[model samples]
Target chain A: MSTQAIIAIGVFLITYAFIVTEKIHRTIIAMAGGIMMVLLGIIGQEKALQHIDFNTLGLLTGMMIIVAITAETGLFKYIAIWAAKKVKGDPLKILVVLGIITALGSAFLDNVTTVLLMVPVTFSITRQLRVNPIPFLITEVIASNIGGTSTLIGDPPNIMLGSAVKELTFMAFINNLTAISFFILFVNIAILAFIYRKQLRTSAELMANLMDMDEKEEITDKTLLRKSLIALTVTILGFFLHQLLHIESATVALTGAFLLLLLTGEKYLDKAFLKVEWTTIFFFIGLFVLVSGLIETGVISKLADYSVHLTGGDVKSTAILILWVSAIASAFIDNIPFVATMIPMIKDMGELGVSNLEPLWWSLSLGACLGGNGTLIGASANVIVAGLAAKEGHSITFGKFLLIAFPLMILSIIICTVYIYFRYLI
Target chain B: MNVAYKYDEKLLELKETANGDDIEFLITLFDSELKKRLIKVREFFEDNKILTDIHYYIHPNNKYQIIVRKDFYNEFLIQLFRQELLQEIKWR
Candidate 1:
């Protein structure tokens, strides 16, 4: 191999190692690597930033703002109570409800936010019911990964994939629903069934005393509540309108978020914005630059050739290969960067001599999103869920998360592969 | 600015006094629509007997910051009220 290629390989491996050990925070390491890439002269600063995918960044930031606003509504805690009650002293039902709501929420919102909103509630409910929160929390981790796989804005990887190619519009995503949703859903449900059959049957009450917490909330001004409703209703309507008008999702989300800030006249607007997680944005920016280093150093073309050879020039074969590999690798390393690196590689697969691998894009998207379930580190969404749940003292250990997440991830990928081959590749 | 000066006496000092992780969540402009929507959610909580962890608010200054988790400061709410008083602000 060439010297530049060797050096690039070294950089990738080092990043990979740090990610796996996770002794060093991934965000810090990523930011440092992003800086290193620029200093090393591997890529120019502007070019590196260009790779950052502002659209994805904007979408995430916008949604986070919305979540920040909505989280205050007592919506999540209220649901937590509902889940605890519905389980009706049944541990299994609690597990199922956690999974279902997580999936649904992740579909509309990003997975990390969904998990962030749910985890604390999950912990408190489980703690009150005197049942282990581990299983229910883990199920949420899996469900978020699976459910977030389908939508363009649901997961970071999908957003990356969307920006990687402009032709892959928001509408195109919904149009391809058969592959993204139905395909992923069946596998998700199957995995949940296999893991929680016994838990579902158990009569262990996980949240018996949770109702008292719900009774204390006072609502004195009925009029103020009415105004807030108008803002929310208008926001949803704006989202659809923007989608049709081809306005970026980020713009729509940000508009909604800012509008709320104006309407409420909250004293803590800055605090809410501050809570938006700038670290996550920095991670994406740095990761984008780091991946650009690979491309600038001629590493992308080389890897593309290798990937094409591995699939033996068959599109179907390449799709399956990319899908499975992405799914597996993402479980161990964060999928956003992994998927980011693969986009150029796959784009090259078809850009040159590797014909018919066009469908590989969808494969990668499906793989990266679904792959998030295999390990806590696989997706940022998983890590946040794990971290947040742990903070709530529910103790979602890496080992336990993987124990549930891995099998479900594998099954979901298998299902995705089948659906893709029949619907697109075959 | 059309300053619509409105304040809930219960939280007049919210600008200075803050306590509990959830105290910030209680302050915002209820105006009619938001209150009704919140009532449905409250009823849902009431039916289930769940405790209120945070009070909801919609900031009129920046409409996107709906569901404010912080208490409404008097100064800020006055500015929002003044917004209606201001002729330039248009409500869709």
Candidate 2:
């Protein structure tokens, strides 16, 4: 390698390590790294912007607006309440309901938005019921990641992976991956339930003291919810309808959001969308450019070549390797960019004649998604959830999360490995 | 077998009025959706008047449940619960 290549490698490693440690905001680290590469002329400005996929950004923005509108309807709250009444303030019920919602939401949207909305409600429910919210919250963080791997629009990483492979369509993604995704989710739900069973069961006569103080605010305007629901439903249906009918995903999502604004009369729309974290968008864009620097300078290709050789070009071996590596990497670094980076590496493996690329992709997806459950900083959803929870004064310590999260994440990964390889490889 | 709906709406007459027991009322339901919203709405009560708790084996089916303890039913809460929100789904 040339001296410039050596310097580039060192810069990338240092940035990667700091991000895993989460000693600072990833946006700061990633954006700084991308700019450093540009200043050094490792890549030009135009090249970097090209690396920054506007489709991913646009898709995310449109989806966020839809979720924002959904939140206004208090549907999540309603669903949560209905679930609790069914299980009756049971911790396991909280986990199951939260888990299902997180996974489902992540499948349709992204984990960050899903968890952002779920965490407070999780905290509220658990706190009211006088139980630890850690387990249920942890499940949401885990399920959201795992479930997000199923579809193209579900997470940034999936989107990056699909577009990197020649802009794979929505149906192509779901058809290829959703079955494995459901299997992973199934195992996750079962294992997490077992882990939190004890703490979730502590009951006392004084329990009712923990209930939330306001039922009134949940009663938002009726017309708003109805209209929001209609718009949101149409958008989701439109996503699935793309193969049979010609509809752009972005146009559908944005139209729903805008229509929601018009339907609800903007009063509620402004309040909801204002909470959208635009900084996250910048972070994704910056990281794309930074990773592009690696690809441009040939680091990604070299790594991919080495990875294929290391696994002896066996799909089974590669799938297992990706699962373990991604799970660990995701536990520390943000999974979106990590998964995004892995997509190209996997394609490179495919070029080297790696069979069963589908299973290998699923392995990477499962690892990153479930692995994020292991650490507080592993996924944006976790960080956002933890941050939002802290703002509510409930301190979900990194240490505490690891205590519950690590085992669940590992077990889930293992389950994923068996299912994917057994079903897909042999 | 008539298993409890994973969720249920119970009109508790107070764990007390059964003959004035100091602990008031204890309302229980299986794990389901209302669990979260019910918890959110709990904050409206005066601190000591209501209580809630999370239990793992709230049911024999291995699912969880949310049980609320309240001195008495609050009408405002009823109206709020009944509010035609997007879809405030509850179980019987």
Candidate 3:
């Protein structure tokens, strides 16, 4: 390997190690690692800038703005209450319904935002129903990760995949992954509901009390809701038609965000911007430059070459290996940086003789996104929910989450193994 | 039955009920400005990291509902007084 390649590998590994240790903030580590690459002459500053995927950052920022404002409208709480009332206030039934709602919400919004909105409502509903909230919280956390697997914009990994490969369009993700993701969601929730069925029971009196809640009262601002719905609709529609419209996903998202700001006027501008997870955005920015060092150094190509040779240039074995490895690795470490590194490697695999890259892309997406359900620390959504629940005195400890979620994650991977084998590999 | 708080309707109306060990408060604000006070009380609870201690809901025309745990009832009342929603508060 060239000296630059060796230095790039060293920088990348040190950065990855720091991120895994969780002692320092991940954004700081990622940014520091990226700066090292530039300062060490592994990659040029201008070339590193070119490597930053603005599409991913723009989409994330835009969606964050939209969800932040929409959240203020009390729409999420309204929907949760409305769904609970629909299920006749049965705790078990409410658990399933909330899981489904979480999945749907995460499919449209980001997983962390979806779970953040769900946690408070979960606590409120469980408190009212007089049942334990841990099951419901755990279910939502898993569902959020699975739900985030279904779309291009749902999970950070998928977003990176969509932006890195033009062929994997918004519709492409919907067509391939959405159905399988929901199928996994159903399987996971069924098991959760069965396990927690005993804890889900509540007195008829409590049920009636929950029923008495006025969901209509939850709409804090109808005017804002209407405008938000309009912007959200246009933005989603833009995603559906973005490929046909020959525009990038980031443009659609930013346009939708700015349109909402226009309709809502300047009042929401600062709030929306404030609500954008700038730390996450910077993390992505740093990761791009860090990965560019490896790419520019030809290290990623060498790894791809080795991987292709190991799989004997076989598509099925390579796809399965990628899928399983991604799932297992993502369960322990952050998937964003993992996917960032994999994207270039996979692209290189294409040049190295992988005739069908379709299955490979889908495998990476499924494995990385759904793999988060394996443990409490697997994904940001899981960690956020655990922290919030612990703060509320309902601790979802690492061991407890692993005891339940790990087996289910394995089961999910088994199902994916079947789906990928049948749907794509065949 | 315990009176959670006594408030002038001009500022806000506090209706209380007991559900097991928890107290539910359905607050209606007559003056639009009192919404800020209610928000302050909500922020106080959130700032303390006591998420489940209260559930705050909003209704049209400046109406709000908050359910408080019995354990946090005293603290909740103190917040109302602090935010000036309650003109005065007394022990006993």
Candidate 4:
């Protein structure tokens, strides 16, 4: 390796170490590493800028704005309270109903936002029934991750993958992963029910208390809710027709955000824009530059060559290898950068005569998205839910979360492994 | 009758010149609202058929003294002064 190549690798490793340790803010770490890559001349400024995937950033920001406005209308709270009522305060029934809502919500809306809406109301319901909120929270986290696997806009990793591979469309992601995601979601519910069977029971009086709550009171702003919902529906339609319209997903998302801002009145523009997770966006930018350095140094191609060699150039073996490795690595590390780095390597493999790259992309998608359930820190949604729980005095320790999460995560991966094998590898 | 309320240290003091029946009604309203908003208090209300361990001082100076528990005090005040409830009671 050349001196510059060695420096690039060093910077990448150090940045990854910081990310994994999570002592410092990930955005800061990523930004510092990205700057180092440019300063070290591993990749020039323009090339680094080129590497940043604005499509993914744009989608995230736009969706965040929509969610922010929608949340302000108390729509998510309304859904949660409504789901709680539907179960009649039956703890297990509440689990299943809320789990499904979370899965579907995460699929359509992003996972973190879905959980942000679901968790507090979950806490409220569980507290009313005198049950531990851990099981429900854990199930929601897992469901969010699985549901996020099903669509281009569902999860950050999927968003990254979708933007990186132009051929991977909105419907393509839905068609490929939705069934598997639902399968995993059902398995998740079963496991949670069995594990918490003792805690998932409540009395008639508790049910009566819950029934008395006026769910309509949860809707803080009905007019804003209507406007936000319309904008969201239009945006989703835009995503579906983007291919036909020859428009980018980013443009579609930004249009929806701006339209909602206008419809909801220009006064909310500042609050809606502020709701965008700038830290996350900057983190993606920094990660792209660092990975771009690896690409510029030919490290990604060499790694792809190494992977090809290990699989003996067999497509099935390569797909399984990527799926399993991505699953395990994503459980510990942030999957965004992992997917970002793998995108180029997989592309390199395609150039190196890997006939079918579609299966590999699917494998990466399933593995990375589902693998987030393995640990508390594995995904942004997990950490946010955990923090919320702790603030409410129901702290979910890392060990406690992993005790259930790790086994369940492994089971989900196994299911994914089988599904990928049958659907693609054969 | 006029009613004045203030938070001092860990206590919520209410000075009411209302008749006993009216004061009783307000207390009931306060308890129900607390049960609705604060989960901890709701759990207590469910277990015991009354508000949990709520102590009050019946004196001229502190007409009603609520010994707000440290944990539930913040939520207690939040519920008592919530805009909608305040509007309903014409306190806002």
Candidate 5:
């Protein structure tokens, strides 16, 4: 009830409201809030600096650079063409194959990058077959979220969680969530397939035409593709060995990005740098300071205490509560700040004598990742894909996307709930 | 036969001339010409069975730039405009 605490809460609420409304650039809102927090004496410059998670920022920037360079190589296009050929242009088959590819790609790479690479090609292939691209695009968005839940580096929330909880390793994430992610992917595809069954039929001639597409022709620069692929591979390998090698994920990612840049020569340095999303990075910076303000003011501790009290100190109930709450909240708001705030609160539970925090972490990851599929505005990837679709004259309205995606997202979360109960709660 | 068009690997730039010597008239003529070319390009792609889409942007300086996905088709369109069609269009 201190004035400073009240002011910090007020600032956080206003910033979050603007972010959800999306009336202005979130980066601007967040930066403004962080500055307000500092100006109000809620936190000092040094404390705010400590709040920014540079590892998460570095990893995001590095992956974005690599993806930007690799995207130009037409590798994504090539994969799309190849997948279309494999399905022989059958609409349902195309959906399943492309969904799996997107899911897998998102598991290893960022979801936004995965979708950015996939959506245009999906549009082109679907257009060629004279089918609507909406179903496939929606499926990809859902799959990207589910797939991203499977690994430490797959989604931003997971990355934040992994960076915060040192005990959570790359292998730990893979072992814990990969199976559930695949399960959700399969279920998601099946649901989409049934919904779009009528559109799944295409003419034999169109199938022949798709099969005739030369995937190699999609590659604009084979040399750059090779180099980018090599860099990505090394970075992934580095992630697997990060615990053993004593290297941070950010270091691995940045090294890989720079190595690829060097290998490709300096001609692309400027363009690659330009491709890094500075606005998103700044948003993260602002959010960190804002959340740090809550932590410093004892507000987060109070919330943690209330949550633990609500669950009556039972780990199972607490994990389940976190799962559902995180899922529903993330469906409407950006999960990054939510998770950033929740991490400390969850850690506080451990500090308050709640042993075995692994399940809580998994629940948070699953809910935050899969819940993003509930609405078009739920995740950054979803919004961008919607924007791209609209630009291409096939706009996916928010209600239309939510109609299909929300139920499917809930189904995925239900599956996660089951996995958490059987695998951890029992 | 002396009409000139500029060609690059991905884009074909066509310059417009107006008959009325009025800026508004010139802009209208340019827009109509751009629309006509876009229709033609669409028809051409339809005939050729090309799956790609055409995108265009008007430069700040009033040059009409048409972009195509395939390099070969871009070159082909440029050549077709230069050799066969450019001189037949009215210019002022």
Candidate 6:
């Protein structure tokens, strides 16, 4: 092993440790690690810059801008209230509906943003019914992660996968992962509904009061809502057809963001940009460079060679191994950096011996995304929801979340194991 | 705005209007002490992470408008009493 590779490994491990401990802000740690890679002569600054995946960043930013503006129109709140009424204010039924709504929202938007939109409404609706909000919040967190597994643009891991591998397009993700993800969502929510049934009961009078709510009045601005819907529809449609349009996903997303800005005029430009989650963007930037150090130093190839040898060049075993390892690792640590390192390793595996990489990619996506439900700190969405719930005096303790979510996460991986074995491994 | 609950006619006045599913409260406080209490009420909700339930708008001449969601009404009143803005809350 070269000295540069050794230094790169040291930097990456230290950075990973700090990120997991969460002693300091993750953004700072990741950025510092990336800079260390450059400063230590492991990777050049320009080479590191070349490694940054702008497509993922662009998609994230565009969707954020669209959601930030759309939120002003009160669309998400309106939908939640409307869905609650549609279920006749039954807490159990509303639990399922909100889970489904949250999943759908996360399918199209970012997971954290979708949860942020859902959390407040979940609290409002649950408070109105005088039921405990913890179950509902837990369900949404799990659902958001599952939903984010279904599409190229849904989760950061999947987004990074799509950008790194050209064959894994938006449509390809929908075709391969969406159905399985939804199936898992149904199974997970059903169990949640059963477990929380006792806590979900409400008085008939309270139910009646919820029924009397006027969902239409929740729309704060009809004109802005209309414009937002138009832009959102076009952006989603663009994702569906980007492959045929011969355009990159980043272009589609940026075009959608700019189109919305144009429609709303200058008033929304500043607000929309301000809400773009620049910290997350920079986090991705730093991670890309940090991983590039491993790639440039040939460490990824060594790891890939070792992994391929361990599996004896069998695609089926390699796929299953990757899936299980990703799920277990992501359950405890940040999946973004995990996936960042694994992408190149998997690519190297393809070069070394693995003939079919499709199954491997899907397994990675399923494991990494679903693994987030294993703990409260497993995903950004989970942590955010827990923080908000704690602030509201409803504590979702790490152990409490792990007890419920870890078992469900194991069940989900079991199902994925079956799906991958039958659908791809066979 | 229709008068919903008036703690004191001269010092604190609360006028309520129903906007869709939420109750918009237009609170006018002639006394600065009442204003301080109202600010505390806002902080309580904010601290609880229920930000959308209340909005505080400052106007000239010490006028304030706070729109609260109907779901948070009871809790809001409880907070007012907790802050000593209300001597007691009665069930109507």
The prediction achieving the highest lDDT against the true structure is 3
Residues A1-426, model 3: lDDT tens digits:
999999999999999999999999999999999999999999889999999999999999999999989998989989999999999999999999999999999998999999999988889888888899999999999999999999999999999999999999999999999999999999999999999898888999879878777788667789999999999999999999999999999999999999999999989889889989999999999999999999999999999999999999999999999999999999999999999999999999999989999999999999999899998889999999999888777888899999999999999999999999999888
Provide all candidates' interface root-mean-square deviations.
10.8, 11.5, 3.3, 13.7, 12.4, 9.1
Off by over 4 Å in 3: B1-22, B26-49, B57-65, B82-85, B88-92
**Per-model TM against the reference:** 0.74, 0.75, 0.94, 0.86, 0.85, 0.87
Model 6 C-alpha lDDT versus the unseen true structure: 0.89
What DockQ would you assign to candidate 6? 0.11
Between candidates 1 and 3, name the one with more favorable DockQ.
Answer: 3
- lDDT: the better of candidates 4 and 5: 5
lDDT, model 6, position A240? 99
> What TM value does chain B of candidate 4 have?
0.30
Better candidate by DockQ, 2 or 3: 3
Per-residue lDDT of A47-147 in model 6, one digit per residue for the tens? 99999998888888888999999998979988998899899999999999999999999999989999999998788787667789999999999999999
Misplaced by over 4 Å in model 6 are B1-92
Candidate 1 lDDT, A1-426, residue by residue in tens: 667666666776687678678888778888778787777776678888777778778877877776776666666665655665665645666677777788878876778888877776665554445456667777787778877876676788887876777667666665664246645665565666666666544323223323323322332434444444555566556554655677776676677777777776775387568778888888888788778888888889888988777767788888888889888988777887788789888878777677665478778888878887888778777777666555544567778777776877787787788878988886
Order of the predicted models by TM-score, top scorer first: 3, 6, 4, 5, 2, 1
Q: For model 2, what is the alpha-carbon lDDT of residue B42?
A: 44
DockQ of 1: 0.03
lDDT of each: 0.65, 0.68, 0.91, 0.81, 0.81, 0.89
Which one is best on TM-score? 3
lDDT of 6 by residue, B42-78 (tens): 6687567564576444434456655576778778778
* Higher-scoring candidate on TM-score, 3 or 6: 3
Off by over 4 Å in 5: B1-52, B55-92
What TM-score would you give candidate 5 relative to the actual structure? 0.85
- List DockQ for all candidates: 0.03, 0.04, 0.43, 0.06, 0.06, 0.11
Q: Candidate 1's fnat?
A: 0.00
Per-residue alpha-carbon lDDT of model 4 for A258-357, expressed as tens digits?
A: 9999898888988888878899999999999999999999999999999888887788999988888898898899999899899999999999889999
| Root mean square deviation (Cα) for candidate 4 | 7.9
> Which CAPRI level is candidate 3?
acceptable
| Stretches of candidate 4 exceeding 4 Å from the true structure | B1-70, B78-92
